[model samples]
Target: MNNTSTTTLTMKREFNVKPEKVFDAWLNPVTMKKWFFTLEGTNKVAQNDPKVGGSWEIVDHRQGVDYRAIGDYVEINSPEKIVFTFKMPQFSELEDTITVELKELGQGSEMTFTQLIHAENEEQWTDADIVKALDEMRDGTEHGWNLMFMGLKELVETGKVSYQG
Candidate 1:
């Protein structure tokens, strides 16, 4: 039998937009290409099938490397919640589940992004290398998500993704 544990990470953000708008941005291919996993000058290709059991993919071509993020929808409650499986095959074999919950607050929306990261193959819990790698992976995932959120904010609020003061 394999023994593994899951580490959960949750992040919250407030956006100056309606819950519907915020939720739709996640499934809209055009909007996703503009912000999701995209760098300033990189080309992004996004394809989203926004239904339960539907699959989605976003590929960012940057620095001559194509980084792909692909996933399948688990649950999608319009303007409320979304759950999907996330994976980046080139980087790691680890597949994680991400849940995004959105609620209307006043005239805007508040989003809670939760990610469940599963521990890899049967490794000793006391292994330093395993601990270190997990820590690094957690940190990197957080940083990447933050960057995407910033881009989302810029695009949803301004209809464009150029850096602003």
Candidate 2:
């Protein structure tokens, strides 16, 4: 999600790998954690269930506060597209959609991540406390995504995943 209010962030990353493998990484828990984060440099995959009513859990042992994103699959097309509703009510945004699309490119694939983020702060203009909370959440969430994606790229390319997700 974009921090610039109402708008969402659209990041496209091209990988020199097969579409099936790339797509599998997204659906397979082990694969997902390897390239799940949009930015990179993050780890800990408790449960990355890809089916409907599945979860994208993480390890809280690395930090003082535990965080998790639970979601249900809205749509799934193997090696092509995936749509899911992600929610972390207490820690971050709720009712967000994470969609990933894979397209073959020459001898590689292009993985596009599109997120629709709702600025919870946009609706709480009158509440200073809520705005403050939302601000911090947005910053933290984006950083997390960044680190996750970076880590994912490294893991996938190296074929050395620390966890199966």
Candidate 3:
């Protein structure tokens, strides 16, 4: 067995927002902050450029601690695909990259996300372990995306950019 634990995980949700708008939520910080956090109490500190070779990092401070994921965009196909690396202490032994793809579903959009996770060895590749990991990642991703979509739909439909709070 290989040391790399690459499970091509995917999830799809048809959102009530245009593919371009959904895509912009990812590229823009104002849109990203509304949904990207693991919890609402956390403060999201982010600076990113939504293009290939550009930086994308978010630091979430909650309670008295900080969690961060910093990486560079490997590629970007506007309103279609986004690929970048990921790392964190709270997530996993994450020396990997996650690629997010958006497909226009009629007037809305569907998102497909894949994460290439790195593990120490095959001993940690049990079905139970991997399933648990995938589940955590999947649920978190879907939840975050849902929040983002809702926030984005509100913004796009209302033509509001700045946060009231």
Candidate 4:
């Protein structure tokens, strides 16, 4: 059985860089290693194929375990928009879709990120339990994305990343 409910999380940020620069940072492996789904002191395996239908994987090798994130690109529009599906096989089977939209704002750019988090087995969980789980997931996901954005901002503005997990 499949539960089709989804919760959408939206976040927005402004960067002191052009849309093209900010957009490219997302797909570039070198830049991605500095921020995207990474933590301090972790060896990164970041690979990207920035095209519609292309797939990406980033594995962070920690002390005793490796955290792997895999995704496939659903849409891509240079300096404007990107849509992709995100999943962590080590965590759960639920896959989420994320959309990143960028627009020029004066001398810089603004990015709007939206994520559709799919609900888990509704049949096995109570409404309160589901709500709590979703709330936690939203909070954690937002924090992770915010950290990534901080790194991205630093990278685009200073050509370096200083944000540590």
Q: Rate the local accuracy (lDDT) of all candidates.
A: 0.83, 0.64, 0.67, 0.86
| Model 1 C-alpha lDDT per residue in residues 1-165, reported as the tens digit of each score | 555556777899999999998898888988888777765367467898999999999888876789998999999999899999998899767789999999999989999999998766454546675667667767888998898899898788888888421
Q: Supply the TM-score for candidate 4.
A: 0.91
Best by TM-score: 4
Tens-digit lDDT track of model 3 for 1-165: 445444554556566677788677777877565545433346467678877889877787766778887777898999899888877757665567778798877877787877665554356468777777666655665565566545555665565534322
Worst 10 residues of 1 by lDDT: 121-130
Candidate 4 residue-wise lDDT, 121-150, digit = tens: 567777777788788878888988987888
**Clashes per candidate (backbone, < 3 Å):** 0, 17, 0, 0
lDDT of 3 at 119: 51
Query: In terms of lDDT, which candidate is strongest?
Result: 4
Off by over 4 Å in 1: 1-5, 39-41, 119-129, 163-165
Candidate 1 backbone collisions, by pair = none
| True lDDT of residue 69, candidate 1 | 89
Q: Candidate 4: minimum summed lDDT over ten consecutive residues — where?
A: 35-44
- Candidate order by TM-score, highest to lowest? 4, 1, 2, 3
Better of 2 and 3 by lDDT: 3
Evaluated against the true structure, the overall lDDT of model 2 is 0.64
Off by over 4 Å in 3: 38-41, 89-93, 122-165
Deviation from truth (RMSD, Å), model 3? 4.3
TM-score winner between candidates 3 and 4: 4
CA RMSD of each candidate after superposition: 2.7, 5.6, 4.3, 1.8
